[model samples]
Target: MSSVSGLVKTEQLYRSQSGWLQRAFAWCGWENGQVMANIRAGRMLTDYGRYHLSRKQFIFAAIAAALVFYMAAYLFYHSALVSIAAAGFGIIAPRFRRRSLLQQRKERLKLQFKEALFSLTSSLAAGRSLENAFLATLDDLKLLYPDPRTELLLEFQIIRFRLENAEPLEYALRNFADRAGIDEITQFTDALAACKRSGGDLLEVMKRTSAIIGEKLEIEQEIAVMIAQKRFEGRIMMAVPFVFLAFLSLAAPDYMAPLYGGIGYLLLTAALLLLLLCFWAMAKMMRIQM
Candidate 1:
C-alpha cells in the first residue's frame, strides 16, 4: 500500500511538471502551430473572468458573416471568383465579433466598477467596516445595475463568499482585482492592501481613489463625445467608395466594364486595400486610450 501511494504521488508530480512546461512553451511563442488547434478546441484565451461566446452566438455570427460577405462580394465585383474570395473574410469575422463583444463587456465592467467604488466610499465614510462596506456596496450596485448578474455585483458576491470563508479582506480584494484584469481595479486593490497593512484610514483612501476614478471616467466620456463626429465622418468616408462604385455600375455599366477584368481587378484590389488602411488609420486616430 505504501509503495502504491508513493508511485501515485510520483506520477502526479511528473504530470504537473509536464503541464507547466507545455504552458510555458505556449507563452514563449514556441507553440505557434497550436493557434488553430487552440481555436478549434475552444481553448482560446478570453477576458479574465468573462464567459466566452455561446454556441448560439457562434452560429449567429457565422450566418451573419456569410450573408454580409456574399452581399458585399456580389455588390462589389459581380463575379463568382470574388464571392468565393470574400468567403475568406467570413472566416476572420467571428474573431473580430468576439473581440468586439469582449471590448463592450470590459467597458461596461469599467463603468460598473467606478459606481461600485463610489458606493464603497460612501459606506466607508458612514463608519461601515470594510467587509460591511463591501456588502452595502452590493446593495447599492444592485440598485444602480438592477441586474444581479452584472460583473461587479457577481465579483462582490465572490469577495463576500471568500471573506465568509475566513480569507483576509486584502486577499479577497486582490483575488477580485486579478479576476477583473482592469488597471483601475488593480491599482485600487494595491492601495487598499497597502493601507490595510499599514493601518491607515481606509475611508480617506477610498474617497481619494473614488474621486480619481470618477474624474478619469468623466474625461474619458468627454473625449468620446469630442471624437463622435470624427467617427461618424470616418464611417461616411468608408461608405463613399462603395456608393460611388455602385452608382458608376448602375449609371454607366459600359464605362465600368474595364474595371471588371484583368489589370483593372488588380488595380481595384489595391485601391480597396488602400481605402481599408486609411479607414483603419482614421479609427486609430479617433480612439482615446484612457
Candidate 2:
C-alpha cells in the first residue's frame, strides 16, 4: 500500500510538471472577431459538427424551424413555389454541411493513417503495451501530423472521460467512432470490442495490422511516384492551349475575331467546359485508395 501510494504521488507530480512545461511552450496569437464569428456560424450549422445532437441543439433546431417557416411565409407573399423551394434548401443545408465535414474529417484520417501506423510500430518496439502505445502515439502525433492527430487525442480523451465516469468501454468506443468520422477508426474500435469480448492477443493483432498498413502505404507511394511525370505532363498540356490561344488573340485580334462571335463563342465555351471535365475525370481516376 505504501509503494502504491508513493507511485501515485510521483505520477501526480510528474503530470503537474508536464502541464507547466506545456504552458511554458504555448503561444499567444492574435485573435480576430471575424474568424471567431465564422467558427461560431459553422458550429451553429452543424452543432459543433458532432455525431449526435443534445437537448439544447434540439431546442435550437425548433427555433430555426420556426424562423424558417416565418421566412418562407414572408417570401411566399412575393413568390409561392420559389419561396417554398428556397426554404426547403435552407432546411437541408445544415444537414449537408454536417455530412461534408464528416467526409473531410474521414479524408484527413485516411491521410494520417500511414503516419499513425509507423508511430504505433515504434511505440510497440519501444516496449509499450497496446494501450500505452496508443496513448504514447497520440502524444507523438500532435506534432507529426495535422488536426486528424488531434482527432486521435480527442478519442483518447473521450475514452479517459468515460472511464473516469464509470461508463462502459463499448459505449465509449462506439461514441468515439461516431465522433471520429472515419471508417477505419470505427472498424478498429469494433476490433477492440471483439478482443475485449473474446479475450485474445490484441497487441499482436495491432502489430499485424500496422505492418499491413505500412506495406499498403509503400505501394501507394510507389504508384504516386510512377504517375508523377504523367500528372505533370497533363497539367502542362492543359495550360499550353490556353496560353497559345491567349497569345494568338493578343497578337492578331482580327484573325481570331470569329472566336468572339455567337456560334464561335458558344463552341469555345463548350470546349473549355469539356476540357475542365476531362481534367477532373483524369485527376479522379489517378487517385488511389486503400
Best by TM-score: 1
Cα RMSD, each candidate? 9.1, 19.9
User: In terms of TM-score, how similar is model 2 to the real structure?
Assistant: 0.53
lDDT of 1 by residue, 67-127 (tens): 7777667666788777877865664455556666776787788889888888888888889
Q: Please, what are the lDDT tens digits per residue for candidate 2 over residues 173-256?
A: 688667655556566667768877898876777667767656765775577677777788888876676667657766987877
CA displacement after TM-score superposition, residue 285 of candidate 1 (Å)? 2.9
Q: Against the hidden reference, what TM-scores do the models get? A: 0.78, 0.53
Clashes of each: 0, 0
What's the C-alpha lDDT at position 31 in model 2?
A: 19
Instruction: Give the local distance difference test score of model 1.
Output: 0.77
In model 2, the runs with Cα more than 4 Å from the true position are 1-107, 117-131, 143-149, 168-170, 181-183, 221-232, 287-289
